[model samples]
Target: MATNKPQTSRQQKHLAVLIDADNAPAAIVEGLFEEIAKYGIASVKRIYGDWTQPNLGGWKKVLLDHSIQPMQQFAYTKGKNATDSSLIIDAMDLLYTRRFDGFCLVSSDSDFTRLAVRLREEGLTVYGFGEQKTPKPFVSACDKFIYTEILRADAVEPAPEPATAPVNGASQEAKPATAPVKAQKVPVDFIAKVLDDIADDEDDWVQLGAVGSNISKLSPAFDPRLYGFKKLSELIKAQPKRFELEARGSNTTGGKDLYVRNRKPGK
Candidate 1:
């Protein structure tokens, strides 16, 4: 049986990270690198924009701090974005080099949709990072798409609501106040379907590692952090009704290996 275990960190992927400074915010740089490190080493990190303009001033310091190469593309005409053209050209140049296993395109612009499609056609995985308002076509083109909102350095966690007091001297149940449940970015039903599709025929239980890999294959940008969970295991644990989780001891080592399966119709 094929295992869903993730490759060792040592077998790191070489990725080319190309950022569109004009469309993406500078605040996400710190978190962005942290996120990318999970997948592999970024072999090439480059940001493109018209450096002469004051609008790109925010990226100046960030570029130096992160060791990102800034490519200047001067705007030759009004109502035209030369940055996108320059990025596309450079991406093609890098793709032809055949050095990178994947390409990380950081932009909220829909114009790069074709570029992503082309890269995928050449068997290169494309990871997209953009704002929530990014076009659906652009998001769908990439192997995985991460929303930049979850990558902000100063991202605010939702505050818990204060407990309500008893009114009119009536005995109020001292119910524990709980934080408001944030709606999951990835729907439960969608996750259930993915789990069911990937479950083994002989055993319904699917290894948590395999489940995570399958999720990434199905939706590259599907991350637990997007839904407030730090790990995939935590995300699975959060939805008890839709799924069941188990930890079985490994044969080689005494450490436990987690497995998950969709809940039965009646159970």
Candidate 2:
């Protein structure tokens, strides 16, 4: 009998971080990396913009610091945005290559909304990050959408001016500068679709894995990474009042586990 050799398994999560320098702030580039680091190793980091424009001056410095490849697109028309077209074409090309596990799209523009949806249709994760002003279409297009303002990259809260009232004049002490209120912009439509899909199933409370699968079916570019959560469990946990979790059973294969879910509050 000949000795049998065990084959080695190759596994790794490869991520691509593509930035629309025109729509994103250079100040948040480092913070973007910090967010992407939690997902998986970023094998490719590229920023798309017109190098000739002075608007991209800040991006030039950050690109050198982060080793991000700069893709320069010239203006083909006076008023039309050419960079967006170039980036979308490149994204489609990369999708066809099928090399990356996920893509991080750092832009607030809704123009890439279709691109995000298309990538997910091909079974690739998409992480979207932008300012709070990002449109509903773009936000809902991703598996998870994040607002960069919450990260507080540039804005620093100043200390409140002390009260000038005499010690005897005021009995109450002055309050220091309270932290800014961070809004949790819930993807109501997306969440509703997921819940509805799960409810439609034979089991009212479907497995979390199944919910995620349904979400991907509904939107291919869905990724939990963009929401400052590495795993779906964490994202759902953060919205406890919106979701309920239950342990269904243990796994006997490949070290995978299972669970069930519930609706968000007021739903």
Candidate 3:
């Protein structure tokens, strides 16, 4: 039977990456770009911050390596954040150009929530990168939200071995500045619910890809990496007790189509 399927080979998207240097840490820059590449070509990369400040020194060091143009926005007032304003203005200007397929906003500040919504209203995808502490409004505003903690763990260069130093009047090795943080456990209930909702009948086979899409819709911040799995399929396969998997046909992505079903009480 002839089937109507969308093209498996997704066209490379053009993205405008805008970074809020004050809100985004420099440690995640390498990983940030790597993640962006997965979505599309970074047609424009610009960061907004006060360059003269010493705190942003780390970002300056990586500017040349990544070819990111720094947009200087000096702090004009004591409490006001001029960088956010500058970035938002530039984002709107870039939106009107109509050249980009999407926008990647790197910041944890909630101030960009409205900006993200405005851009999406114009039909551009918004990918937000922020820390775990990022406001839910901003996180929910983007089409996809990636926590920077993951990026730091994945891409930041590891620090050198610590030298012996005096501690509490005795010579001892200094402890590591960054201790490894454990990933949160996968939301099994959420996955089970999505699978059941999609299934036409009990034990009916459902496309894994469809379940993945529904999960994303329910939780934009849902990433298999959070649970230490590289892919959705890997995560599902790990929980064999609750789900059954079957392969029926080949797909365009050079991989076989995987169908999933809710496991019955027995066999």
Q: What are the Cα lDDT values of the candidates?
A: 0.84, 0.72, 0.87
Best to worst by TM-score, what's the order? Answer: 3, 1, 2
Question: For all the candidates, what are their Cα RMSDs to the real structure?
Answer: 7.8, 7.6, 4.8
In the predicted model 2, the residue pairs found to clash are 120-220, 120-221, 143-222, 143-223, 242-264
What residue pairs are clashing in model 1?
Answer: 144-220, 144-221
Q: What is candidate 3's CA lDDT for residue 136?
A: 98
Best-to-worst ranking by lDDT: 3, 1, 2
Candidate number that wins on TM-score, 1 or 3: 3
**Model 2 ranges with Cα > 4 A deviation:** 1-11, 154-267
Q: In candidate 3, how many clashes are counted?
A: 0
**Per-residue accuracy of model 2 over 1-267 as CA lDDT, tens digit each:** 876764322124678888898998887776678777866678888888889999999888877789999998998989878989988888888877878888889899999999999988888878898876788898888876756654433222233334566677757655432222233344646865677766855546666777777876576445454444556776777776657767645575645464545664575
Residue-level lDDT of model 1, residues 1-267, one tens digit each, is 999887745238889999999999887888789878877889999999989999988899788789999999988898788999999999999999999889999999999999999999999888899987899899889988988877773232344346678899888776322212343565787788888898767668998888887777777667677676778898889888888999998755678999999988799
Tens digits of per-residue lDDT for model 3, 141-170: 998999888887772233434465677888
- Which candidate ranks first by TM-score, i.e. highest? 3
Candidate 3, residue 192: how far the Cα is off, in Å: 1.0
Clashes of 2: 5
Candidate 2 lDDT at 204 equals 60
* TM-score, per-candidate, Cα-based: 0.82, 0.61, 0.87
